[model samples]
Target: MGGRVSEPTTKASQFVVAILAKSGNIVTLYQLDVNNAFLYGDLHEEVNMTLPEGYFTENDKQTEGNMFISLFVYVDDIVITGNDIDEIKRVKTFLNSKFLIKYPGVLKYFLGVEVLRNDENICISQRKYCLELLNDYSMLGSKPANTPIDLGLCVVCSPSEKDNLLSNITKYQKLFGRLIYLTLTRPDISFVVQILSQHMHAPLQSHLNLSFRTLRYLKGSHGKGVRMVKGNELSLKAYCDADLGKCKLNTRSVTGYLVYFCNSLVSWKSKKQATISSSSAEAEYRAMGLTACEIIWIINLLRDLNINVKLHVELMCDNSSAIQIAAYFS
Candidate 1:
């Protein structure tokens, strides 16, 4: 059977890839697929098959059993995945010995995404996918912006913001959905995507214009991606900050926190806080506590990684009064 979307020689999606634990210190995640995974067993005795063109002169010696391998047909496609690479290679060899053989390498990218993995971390992104989206939306030629949301910009379209819904309003919503998926690797664009998504159900022309700010940012950050680092230092560290009263619509505080894997950013989020803080100290203290939870989770994940880490995480907050309050809580 033919493989999926990629060239047979270079891609490895025909087989499956997975990582498994070995000896607690070593992890072996092998990827292999049956070359013709479905064509594994010998054919049934009742089936008599004619030989293909040119193989036999009607005088070729017949094997004791049927000539066909087990055929599980799914529109002539096959898929196989297992922990043993040798068994996989053996299957490939057996198939090659019996019929035409072709295979690909480690399963990196499939469908539209490009996947890259290392001991430090795994990175998945769709730069190609986004470019396609941009080209489809005629945004490939638009000027690039450095940030997803401009600090100078404010949402002003309102009160009958309904009147100017884009004739292409659905297009605007579609791009928002794509961009929101992209935020999985780019939390830096979170606040922007979240803000634009607020208007997706009833997007106006002004709303549509404001949404492209993220696409502009994506244009510039074509190379930006997440990295999880493997490090000798195992202590969790978190940094939290707040821009007091940043939301223009309400006096809500925007809480931002960064969680690190060693020194690398693994998870971080920025969103408007739910409740109003009575004082700057209270806001800062709240940020520290939220980020502290992040630190604890990271520490536990590291333990799962078998790093044998301690729970001595530092939650950094700039407000001295907040720090003083933290000491009281501790």
Candidate 2:
């Protein structure tokens, strides 16, 4: 059963913010929890299994019926969102008749992210999660840093630098994992996290030091997060830039991009390019290609949600040569 289960695309915080910004004061959002959601999913393949010790069925077997409602499920946690109040209520009624469920009024918290809303704007933050992470690392009282990573500092792993490696690899892995999750709401640290994650296999002490520095930066800006305000415009805008051959160890360019829907950031990424490029223009062009794909994806998603985006999507780049190359190639 475990191997057969398929996960659904859970709603991202950025998407939620975008939806809120578009909804303005006309739409009402609601949350629903379907108990034992996995049990509700109909299985296509057949396999015999013994019933639980205390359970019984007509023939010691059970099967689920087809799902009818427009629902999004992430494991057991489900979020039911739409503008039609009557339709949303009808779906809840249907689910209640079939399965045990709970309707938590209005969404304030989902997953680990916190949501705060007013009449005109929605603010998303992970302050509670960030603080807990800091305390777990014994950095609650540590001095705050102005920046997450030092721009001039470059980290590289060397076998000869034995004293520069951490004794416990597990601790380094754990910290790295948490920091990756933190990037969800903290775009400021996305680039640094991308750099530090490369050396996860054999992290050096310098990596550990830089990780702590990121923690100190989080301590200073723990309350900072993304805010989406109501707007009349429905437009897509993207900005992409690349640091040519930024990785000293692998000579790979670092690509970074940020995408916004009506001035609200909804998607972003910071990653290393797969293949090495000889020129800065080539790296920038590759970065633009990646950003273009993301733009098209977002456009398709918006179309699915019935959001009419009539304006042509705009792409911004700093390099004129890259822009000219993209223009010529297209």
Every model's TM-score = 0.62, 0.85
**The CA-based lDDT of model 2 is what?**
0.77
Runs with alpha carbons beyond 4 Å of true place in candidate 1: 1-107, 110-113, 117-124, 160-170, 202-204
Ten-residue region with minimum lDDT total, candidate 2: 61-70
Q: Please write out the lDDT profile of model 2 over residues 92-210, one tens digit for every residue.
A: 89878988888888777766778788877788789999999999999999999999987778676674545466778899999989888878788999998999898888888888888
Writing each residue's lDDT as its tens digit, candidate 1 over 116-207 gives 76665555566777788677777888899978777867765353645576666678878888887676557788777766676777677766
Residue 277 Cα positional deviation in candidate 1, in Å, after optimal superposition: 2.1
Clashing residue pairs in candidate 1 are: 15-33, 19-29
- RMSD values for the candidates in order, in angstroms, are 14.2, 8.4
Q: Candidate 2, which segments miss by more than 4 Å at Cα?
A: 1-7, 11-14, 38-42, 45-70
